[model samples]
Target chain A: MPSIKQIARNEAASSRFVSGHSLCRGCGIPVVVRTVLNSIEAPVVVINATGCLEVATTRYPHTTWQVPWLHIAFENAAAAASGVETAYKALVKRGRLPDEPIVFVVFGGDGGTYDIGLQALSGALERGHRFLYVCYDNEAYMNTGIQRSSATPFAANTTTSPAGKQSFGKLQKRKDLTAIVVAHHIPYAAQASISHWQDLSDKVVAATRLASPSFINVLSTCPLGWGLEPNQTVRFARLATETRYWPLYEVIEGHYRITEQPLDPSLPIRAWLEDQVRFKHLFQHEDAEVLARIQREVDRDWNNLKRRSEADAQWFARHSERLAKEWTGSAARPAPAMTSRTNTNP
Target chain B: MPLKAPKIAPSARMRLLTGAEAAAHAMRQINPDVVSVYPITPQTPIIQTFAKFVADGETDTEIINVESEHSAMSAAVGAAQAGARTMTATASQGLALMIEIVYIAASMRLPIVMAVGNRALSGPINIHCDHADSMLARDSGMVQILTENAQEAYDLMVMAPRLAEHPEVMLPVLVSQDGFTITHSAEPVSLLPDEEVRRFVGDYRIPYPLLAGEVVTQGPFAMPDYYFEIKAQQVRAMRAAAQVFDELSEAYQACSGRRYQAVEGYRLDDADRALILMGSSAGTAKEVVDELRAKGEKVGLAQVRLFRPFPAAALREMLTGVGAVAVLDRALSFGGTAPLFAEVAAGLFGQTVSLSSQVYGLGGRELFPEQIAAVFHDLESTEGLEQPRFIGLRG
Candidate 1:
């Protein structure tokens, strides 16, 4: 069996898109996108939701995309991709497209996936399209200049939800998109961070293999949007996971499994919060009680997730075996019989 | 042996179909891949018909009933970007509500086609024929096409997506039909055969970036470094749509044996005075022009078909040698001149023509043929109408 490093190296070597068409320096979105793209070998069509990713990559007449990329309106990437995927499947069934498994993925920012695009995403997931949706969660509406999104962390400074004398930045906690996706009872759902490149790539690869809808909520970093130095993107992302501020986990067939357990006596949530300008006001105000409340909330959520993971161990083990069997069986089987229908216009 | 091109009726018997029905017929002929629709009259019937078609499995198209006009356009942009021919319809307040995202759709160049039931912008709240809703979207980089009657409304709807998705013209198209005048008014319209339309328009071939399996970046964040150039590209695409419009219209005429010009002229060949108008008001003005000609008066009419590229050169050529032109505008510009009239006057600048503009039919007040005829008579008698006069204003 190949090691994880060997697997990553092979995937990287076969990267479909060329490097550098103009993303901001150290942007985590492109990194996650590239890793995801490299992990899959199928013919991939990407539907990009309106947000930082769409705004950063495509400028008309000149683009950095090396594969079929579409920039649809914000809030409908899932619906749009469902159309594409549906068309592709229908065409394949009719022998219009080649009899090969194709990958249809929708890439959305936090605002597009968790806020405005949520309804469409929910519909697509419920409809059960064989597609993967990747939500690059940078926590705020970063493309529109650090505006507050539903995924924006509690007590964090954003343009619309600013922390002032009367208030702390955002009063609400970050939306649980993973829970939302899992609620749809999709075959697979995972939470990942850009800092863990290998883990992210593995999750994407696993997601594409599922027969039902799969979602990967990636914790992406935005230096400019978050008011941090460019070089600290990866470091901040790592700290987030380490402190259990952004836990890494996966849900499969209604079962939760912790992919990366935070070490005993996890780092204080304050350490992760103080790293960015968004939480600076909380530190300056000496709001110990607010900080304590945030810490307690994180601790409670982490403990709950940990307990669920422990309870679902047997289910996940069985799921892993079934997945392995399916993968091996698919590999052994010949390609599905090609349909005789001709797509060519007479 | 080469297979002969499929033949259909030269012109089917014209039937009076509502503007909504006309739009529905056009959508049925095109058979787009997806129609992301949220119903708002006088635009609801169009989507309703489309939804019925999808449900009946008459057309192999996806019908998504979204939450709002915002979501409708959003879904359209998404579907179109995913390389599917997609469209939606909205009107008046709905259009105004979607103003911001509409601009984004244009800048993104998603090739989305929308039908706007031209209605009044709100203040005291009214829903009737006026160009204010669409006029507010003038700078959104969409190829705005105004239809004068049910026939033009139907023809333009079929022609719009083709022009919008052209490689050189990958911008959205707005097919505006007056809210009540055309949208609700039933008029005889020739529905083109689906095969003929498919032959004329051909399959939508999105150029470089948007096709499936091609990783092309779209709608990227354009900072100070790239925003201006991206805008310039959008402008270039809109300008390029002019030639495509002409090409498509000619092909459409060849296929259906009926023709539509970018600017339709009625009795303007040997006339000294003419009336310029857009949308359904053109139908009224044309009637007025014919009546004046029968009365031994030399008056004609020019109707604007394509509004986005403005058809400035075409208007200038059509209006040349005509001694005077009165532009009847159905929408107000507020604090400035009438929107369509302002564009016309700007086009005719430096040309030897006595020009005047009048704002009428504000908030869906009817502009009858007699009212237009009265305006023409006023223009004939007066040297220059100093300011735009409202014909149907109540004191």
Candidate 2:
């Protein structure tokens, strides 16, 4: 993991993502994008879904990206990455391109990852494409305005799920997207936050090293949508992990490891929710029942993660070598056969 | 280790192949860097045959059997932008689903080739021969080529990538074959030598390819100030495709001994009445033209090989001296004039020719010789043809 000083060095040495763009002041997306891009050692080709980062960064005749970047639509970033990765394989195999280490990265928002793009992402993962899919989970569709996405938390007010006499806010709990990615049995999947820069950086590096698909769901802050002061972006992101509302952990080859153990595991989930204006109605109405329900859900989720990590640690200790062998062996075995016809016409 | 080219040259051979299989053979010869596809009826066999080629180690192409046609086209776009030769295939609903990205592929200037097994769009959920699928993507900015038979399907599939990858015309190409009629029906197809085809396509290299050492941004968002200009560049490319298609078809004819043109006229010289259409129905119409000509009716047929650029000039030139013209359309445009008829009307707006529109073969409704002959007979009177006539319908 790179320290803040080292991250600054990396940024200076290779300014892959530049600073001038139209993203809201102090938006957490740039932090996530810059950190993720700077963390990788190899050349990267980024596939972005149409969202705040893509639309804002690369408006025609202007671009903040210094590295190769592609944006197709609001959804299908993973599918696009799958294509780039496959093309690299096909080209290198045929000697049309030099065989060099190139990392394929996908940047998608919560709406693109957890909602419309789910099928494309799932298909790419199942096909076992070597790429890293990073979802900047801002909890709502910030680009199209504060629409309630599947990643939006329970009772969090959004434009689509606005609080009213008939409704409190969004009715459903946020989907456990990291767990869903892990369920695909990919080589690596993790839950990260922009606040924990080192953890997110380490996960990006690790995810890119895998020979198969990997996913990282990073909790990104939206100062405008979440109704926070420009400077409070990192503070709220840290609150998310500290309150155990969004735990920091990773699953590697089915082995779970808790990357960050919150200093105060018993911290109230309200610590994360109370600061955001989206959740202000819950406090104003003195909705004790809703607040308690949120707490219970967080507690249950945190406990489940901790239990899985502990169980996985014991099993992995004995089977680490075998698991590593089986994973890498399956990836390397049966290399696709290459055949070509005679060039009589040439 | 460098791959050594085999000394033995592959020879051209005539083979009885389904249109889908013919497309597969064309793909096999092209041996593109990547092919992404999903299984849709009529279009399925094309990829299925290609999959066997990959499995049998005949080609080293990276085959991605995507979950949906949307992903298939999406992956193809990505691969193309990443500087690989890419292709895909789909049918009606599949084409409908994939059309969004197809538009993007054109706008982004990725030379991805897609094979569309033309089928009717659903409501009654019919899966049969019709132009509804490709017609849905009529304005998508991709080049649309309609094939008359399995032979044309093979020949055009071989030519599509080269046309798409043309430096001046880097747009996606949709080479369509009528569903069931050509895709499933077997016919004698003359395949060019594999090496000849490999040389014809050459290597696909593009400027500012992704992962090409230098970083480049593609598919960027365009604001109002710059969006129209960017679209104008695409318009120029489509215009360039018309001439490029002719140049390529002539080049292909030189080697394959099979000539192709944007619009092919069958005995239109000094004819009084002409029928114009596209796709497999041209075969049926040609036979009707022959039957009518023997009886001294002076009838002719104009088949459109390229539909996207509309081939208006060649079509109008062929129908210039003809007195009466009937435009047959396989797909309906509902409340509007049929798509082909609209184009024909627009093309011949000031021409001194009497025009009529005929709609037929919806959801693979049979288009027989008699029906085509009736369309010719209807052209004689040229009355009550203002409202698009539906042929072979029991009124």
**TM-score of every model?**
0.83, 0.95
C-alpha lDDT values of all predictions: 0.78, 0.88
Summarize candidate 1's per-residue lDDT along B1-395 as a digit string, tens digits: 12221122335556668988898888887887777777776787788877787678767676766666766676677666656677889998889867776888788787888988888877878877788888888999988999977888888888888898888988999998988778887766778777877676667656543444445665555567878988999989988998999998888788667677878888989888888888877766766777778889999989988889889999888888898888888888779998888899899989988778888888888777777888888767556575678887879
Q: Which predicted model would earn the best lDDT? A: 2
DockQ (Cα-based) for each candidate: 0.28, 0.68
What lDDT tens digits, residue by residue, belong to model 2 across residues B269-361? 999999999999898888788888989999998999999888898888888799988899999987899999899999998998888888999
The DockQ-based CAPRI class assigned to model 2 is medium
TM-score of 2: 0.95
lDDT of 1 at B173: 93
Q: Using TM-score as the measure, which candidate wins?
A: 2
* Model 1 chain B: lowest-lDDT 10 consecutive positions: B1-10
Model 2, which residues run further than 4 Å from truth?
A319-346, B1-12
